[model samples]
Target: MGASLNEIKSKIASTAKTSQITGAMQMVSAAKLQKSENHAKKYQTYASKVKQVTLDLVSHDKGPSKNPMMLKREVKKTGYLVITSDRGLVGGYNANILKSVMSELMKKKNDDAFSVMALGGMGADFFKARDIKVSYELRGLSDQPNFEEVRHIVSEAVKLYQSEEFDELFVCYNHHVNSLTSEVRMEKMLPISFDDVTSTPSLDTFELEPDRDQILDQLLPQYAESLIYGSIVDAKTAEHAAGMTAMQTATDNANSVIHDLTIQFNRARQAAITQEITEIVAGAAAL
Candidate 1:
């Protein structure tokens, strides 16, 4: 019993150390979550402004004028852009979003309706393992992503859309509402919707130095990139928030485990001491 008590004490100590590590990680993730959340909100504003400007310029009643992204093509194939975290340990953060996207795909008319361009390893591997077609895969992005890193992927997706290769495009990601809550969101990227238009004041309404039509031809693609970039930022915010919460829960669980183990250790030690006293008293009585 003495030996068992010591062993259990050692386990408790090890668990305590692990809990400390997780606690530190929780703090770090909390700080990151704050920054990411702010950035996501700011980017959304910029994206919204861009969308509104584009919509106002292209607000013709007839429809979009020869815009590839706005054109509705026959569905030869579709693309799913799965945005998930590269690493795990964020509770149901990745799983919930992935499952939502998979369930959505399962409901599509064609059994194998879409290919994926995965932004993270988990979703990439998930699609590959399932023999779902994958057009591209990019991973190892930082906690706070900059738009430059993912330009290649965005360009490729845009090119594919322009070439009439993919009739539709979707980005499946988790949107950060707050630290404690997030929602798995699916955004349609191609065949741009009227709702994409926003109400922003900063976009110059009277600046006609470069002519709206020519400027729009160039601005539309950049605006599309902004949407992708904004989504990535939003997804990252959710990831950090989820990670912080998960780590805090892990720390709490570890502390609870240590509490139980310490109680067991104390009982074992007391039992061992009692046994020693009992043996000595018995020996004296026997003498």
Candidate 2:
């Protein structure tokens, strides 16, 4: 049977409500994304500069070589740092990171030889469901993230790597490029490539406070901290942008469905009235 007028009206009203909610969400996401992108840009400059300086300091073995964060160890067990969104309805935001991690797992010769840690709810659940060894997970990460929040998690991972629990560590996240484009990214964090340091030469002489070892002791941790913070900012921006686009698409689809349903409802109602009027006219003519 075709839908009645009341049914059609109700459907339209429901769709309208949904559109309103989605519209509001899109605006909110856009605003958040804007702020996130700005943060990313500003921090990216600093992060790149930090990485360059790090590479410069470690060159010629001038910096602390024995530090776990700076040590080069044998690749026996792999450690992964996975970042994803805590909530859903963000299109492929969570799935993208999950797939990258899955790809790494699938390609590995010894899945049992590796351990993982998640930075969000989706990643934590995905690894748990698969029975993968997850050392740590931080859920419900906020829009503006701080390194202080995840410092312990990083420390544990670094310590584990030092202790030979994992020889190397990797990270997977979404890299925010623009409002419409976010790319899935997989990055390795551990065994800070001292070799990569030589490739990048420092333009300025980094003056050490008291001495180079003392300065390095403080700088290395800050460098690693900045790396994590920058990644979080990039991932969050991508998440918001993806959600806004996905919601807008859903709203459009709902509008189209309601339009088709209303047309069907109107056509059915018109036919029913026409049939009743024709029968009455025939009866009158017969009389």
Candidate 3:
């Protein structure tokens, strides 16, 4: 009885330690999630303004000054810039995004039909393990990523599209709907179409400095880079939220286990005490 009680006590201690670790992780992830959310929100304003100005220029132009990014061509090869977290313990976060990419890849008739640009270590390793070609890869992004960190990869993707390496490019990631819910999303990034731009009624007009075409030549690429950067910010937010929720669940489960073990320990101790009392009473009667 003593041995059993001691075992239950040990289990309770171990479970409580686990609960503490997970609880700490949960708090850290929550803090990161808040920071990521704020960064993403602030970035959206700049991204929207850039898109608006780029589209406005496109709309007002009457000439045949069609930017190459805006023109659509035959899509012989496609590119996927997949975003995933470098670390694990984010419940189903990496799995769902990878699954979504696989589902899209399964649609291709040929193995060489598409290539991938992985933005995180998880995605980079995943694609490489399958012998899939990963043209560009980056890892170890901060919890709240900055645009400069991702600019090089974004520029490379846009350049590849322009070079006709892939006629179209898509970015895949998990979209944060709430703290507890996220959904996988694939967004087209290349062959920029005016139709894809969100339309807003604006009475504002801008006086051109150099020329509309020249400004577009610079603005269009920046706009595409901004799109990629914005997606990365959003994906990071989702990753943090997923991590926070997963840690919270783990802590809860550990605490539940601890509770059960504590109850068992109490019952065993009580049983031992009762047995000792009965033994003493029997001795007294015999005397």
Q: Write the per-residue lDDT of candidate 1 for residues 20-76, one digit (tens) a residue.
A: 999999999999998887787777788867877777766633345576666678887
Residue 189 of model 3, lDDT score: 86
Q: What local lDDT does model 1 show for residue 132?
A: 76
Q: How high is each candidate's TM-score?
A: 0.91, 0.87, 0.94
- Quote the lDDT for 230 in model 1: 83
Point out where model 3 deviates above 4 Å: 62-65, 196-207
lDDT of 3 by residue, 1-287 (tens): 98898888888888888899999999999999999888888998998788887777777644455789888888898999999999899999999999999899989988778989999999999989988889999998988878778988999999999888998999999988888999898999888877755665352465678887888899889899998888898899999999999999999999889888888888889889999999999999999
**TM-score rank order:** 3, 1, 2
Q: On residues 99-137, what C-alpha lDDT tens digit does candidate 2 reach at each position?
A: 877987888887677788899898898888988877889
Q: Against the unseen true structure, what C-alpha lDDT does each candidate score?
A: 0.84, 0.78, 0.89
Top model number, lDDT: 3
lDDT score for candidate 3 against the true structure: 0.89
lDDT order of candidates, best first? 3, 1, 2
lDDT of 2 at 89: 84
Error of 1 at 131 (Å): 1.7
Error of 2 at 111 (Å): 4.5
